[model samples]
Target: MNEVAILCVDDETVILESLQEQISRHFGEQFMYEAAESAEEALEIIEELNQEGVKIVVIVSDWLMPGMRGDELLVKVHQQFGDITTIMLTGQADEKAIERAKREANLYCCIHKPWRKEELLKIITTALESV
Candidate 1:
């Protein structure tokens, strides 16, 4: 079977760790979980994984970051890798950013910060099903 990955990008290390842990716990060993501290790092990871023949099926990203914003990253990803599913996880994102992501990136869903584990898992499950 082809290897698949799930990438979580956030500027906060704690958030990234929490997301990776929660997703791994819920999904077991079904997917390779990756965490990046910035959009640039996330893009690097995505490219490296693709080089290794691992398809990244989902990306969950925080909106406000130092460099490229999550929505911008998602839109770039959508342009380069149209098949990957993108989700926004943000506490401070405005409606316009979310709408832009939805319109341009085909965002799978937008989950607010302090998201319930169940909701995150459900959205991920749905995204995987769609993939």
Candidate 2:
């Protein structure tokens, strides 16, 4: 079976590392974990993985980045791959951006920065369950 993926996008290397560690620890070998430092890189990774017959089950993205904010990335992802669930993990996203993600991206949820590990894990678990 093609392995399903959980992709996390964050400009900060530390944040990306931590997210990957947490997800790997909790999920073990159940899902493939992928990370990208920018929206453009993440999109490329998604396309490559899709071509390999991998299903991307979820994306957790940071709101503030160098270019193409999380909301915009998720919206674009939704337009191309509507079935993939999305979660915004942001420290500084405005209300308008969040609403746009909800409406256009079918955002699963938004978790703020300095997030509780349990909360983040729970939200991801819920999203995966629905999938």
Candidate 3:
């Protein structure tokens, strides 16, 4: 079977750690979990994983990063890897950004910050089922 990965991107280190912990606890070793501090770093990780034949099935990202915002990042990822599902998990993203991600990136879903763990896990589970 091909290796699978789930990437979580956030500018905050604490948020990144929390997300990774929750996902790992819920899914166990079912996926290779990756965390990036910025959109640029996330893109690099995606490229490296793709080259290694690890399929990145999902990306959960924050919107208010230093450089590329989550919507922009998702759009780029969608353009390059259309099969990968993108999700926005952010506190400060405006409605326009969410809509743009949905329209341009074919984003899987948007979850506001301080998300419920169960809800996140459910969304991810559904996305993986579709993949």
Candidate 4:
């Protein structure tokens, strides 16, 4: 079986870079990490990757995005692709947003900003194990 690929989306380039670097440092070559600057770009990349038969097992998205928020993106992704795990990464997500994601999306977990490497690894490992 192919290794689990992870897609992380954030509007801020700095945040995106940090996530990519931290996740890579933690997991090494165990996961295929891909980052997108926005939900639109992320959706496009997901489509392309899916077409290539490179299944993305997890998606970590920021809640406060420019266009579609992380909750919306995750809900949409879950609707089309049921097996892809969705995790929200945000400094703070409102109650309404969290409720929506919980109802419509299969949220693995929410990781706050300035996350610790160990916590992120544990979440990823657990999420993958559930698959």
Task: Tell me the alpha-carbon RMSD of every candidate.
Answer: 1.2, 0.9, 1.2, 1.6
Residue 24, candidate 4: Cα error in Å is 1.4
TM-score of predicted structure 2: 0.98
Encode model 4's per-residue lDDT on 70-116: one tens digit a residue: 99999999999999989899897997988798889978898888788
lDDT of 2 by residue, 1-131 (tens): 43899999999999999999998899889988899999999999999999999999999999999989999999999999999999999999999999999999999999999999999999999999999
Clashes of each: 0, 0, 0, 0
Off by over 4 Å in 3: none
Any runs in candidate 4 off by more than 4 Å, and if so which? 1-3
Estimate the TM-score of every prediction: 0.97, 0.98, 0.97, 0.93
Where does model 2 exceed 4 Å of error?
none
Q: What TM-score number comes out for model 1?
A: 0.97
Pitting candidate 1 against candidate 4, the one with the higher TM-score is: 1
Supply the global lDDT for candidate 3.
0.95
lDDT of 1 by residue, 79-128 (tens): 99999999999999999999999999999999999999999999999999
In angstroms, what RMSD does candidate 3 have relative to the true structure?
A: 1.2
Using TM-score as the measure, the top candidate is: 2
Candidate 2: residue 116 lDDT (0-100): 90
Cα distance off (Å), candidate 3, residue 37: 0.4
